[model samples]
Target: MMTVTDLDCLRGQRRVLSGVSFALDAGDCLILRGPNGAGKTTLLRTLAGLSPAPRGALSTAPEDLVYTGHLDAVKPQLTVAENLTFWQGIYQNAPQDTLNSFDLDELADRPAATLSAGQKRRLGLARLHVSGRKIWLLDEPTTALDADHVARFTDTLQAHCNGGGIAIISTHLDIALPQARTLNVADFAARQDRTADEEADPFLQGAY
Candidate 1:
């Protein structure tokens, strides 16, 4: 389980959100919705432990959290299979046909540099299959996916939740997620003072 209490986050030296709180247990999903610059990404970054939650409580450990931001993090020179293999190794897990899951089996040998934008996005998402972490933090996950792939991704999320994993995704797309809660990030946005130098919060780290 993951928990947040009265969370306040900052971007640079300015606080972008405050008084934010939520709890996500096994098999739950939280969807973040808000306008541009409403701090959705910042909130996720804080939750993922990429940034500090200056004021609040977060319960989790780093090893249990998996975060995928706007960038794909794919190496242009690596093949699809190679990319998945690298992440699979990091998680100390064997390959689990992630390519097939994303319908990239045929393109497994192709270099990421040759893929289209949508294909590259799919490759980025495929990393989810390799991560054995319990908590997922995804930003704009469905950006370049087609309707069919979106549907597949929804099914994947449902399966993950059913297996007792929790996910928080920020997206504008309409996708069905089991037991999903919608959170409008704007509701948590607030302005506050912050010092130029501050250490990151350790409470937000995920469990192994």
Candidate 2:
């Protein structure tokens, strides 16, 4: 199980979100919903431990979590198969059917740079499967994906949850995951007025 208590998130020196709390058990999925700049990414980063949470408690080990942000994290020079293989090495997990898993069989030998945006996104998402972690913290996972691939991604997420994994995704699209519950980050927006220094910080005003 994973638990969050009174979580407060910041972007640089400014607090963007506060008093957020949630809990998830195995086989659960939580979808984060909010308008742009509502601190959805900040909350995800905080949960993944990539960013410090000024005030909160996260009851999960770092080893159990896997985080995927907007970037695909692909090596442009590497072939599709090589990319998955590389991540498998990093995660120290057994090899997965990478080609078939994300419908990249035909492009397995092709360089990642040659692939289109959607293909690169698929390759990035496939890393989640290769990670073999219990908890997933994803940000805008379906950004460049078409409808068909989005469905494929949904199936992949469902399979993960069915196998007792937990997923927390931040996305604007209406992804069809029947069992997934939604959390609107806008509800947790920090109510404090920003100081002059915070207002002048570009990092705070930009996407959190």
Candidate 3:
């Protein structure tokens, strides 16, 4: 089980969302819904420990979580198989059929830089299988995927949850994951009143 209570999210010292809270048990998925700049990414970054720890509690251990952001995180020069193998080595996990898992077997030897956008997205997501973590934090995971690949990814997500994993995703698309609940992040928007000092700082202007 994972629990977050009274969480606060920030973007470069500017508070964006506050009093965020949620809990999820094994085999659960939560979808974050909000418009651009509504702090969805900030919240995910905070939960993934990429940002400073906020004024709240996260019950899950750091080692149990894996985060995937907007970028695919692929190595351009590496072949598809090599990329998965590289992550498998980093996580020190036993070998997994990652290529087959994401339907990358046909292009296993292709360099990541040569693949289409959707193929690269698949390769990026395949890293999750190699990661062997219990919790997944994804941001707009289906960015470039076509219909068929989207269905494939949906099945993959279902399989993971069925195996007692947890997923929290932020997406504008309506992905029909069974029993998944949605959280509208706009509800937690923080009200900021900038002080004179803050207003005078050129670096702070137009910061997201």
Q: Can you give the lDDT of residue 177 in candidate 3?
A: 86
> Which candidate number maximizes TM-score?
3
Residue-level lDDT of model 3, residues 108-207, one tens digit each, is 9999999999999999999888899999999999999998898989999998999999999999988788779999999999888877888999998965
TM match of model 1 to true structure: 0.89
Across 70-106, the per-residue lDDT of candidate 1 in tens digits comes to 8998999999989988888888876566777788999
Off by over 4 Å in 1: 192-208
Q: What lDDT, from 0 to 1, does candidate 2 have?
A: 0.91
Residue 110 Cα positional deviation in candidate 1, in Å, after optimal superposition: 0.2
What are the per-model C-alpha RMSD values against the true structure? Answer: 8.0, 3.6, 2.7
lDDT tens digits, residue span 1-208, model 2: 9999999999888999999999999999999999988999999999888889999899999999999999999999999989988998999996557678799999999999999999999999889999999999999999999898998889888989999999999987886877899999999999877678888999889433
Model 2 TM-score is 0.91
- The count of residue-pair clashes in candidate 3 stands at 0
Candidate closer to the true structure by TM-score (higher is better), 1 or 2: 2
Report how far residue 108 has shifted in candidate 1, in Å.
0.5
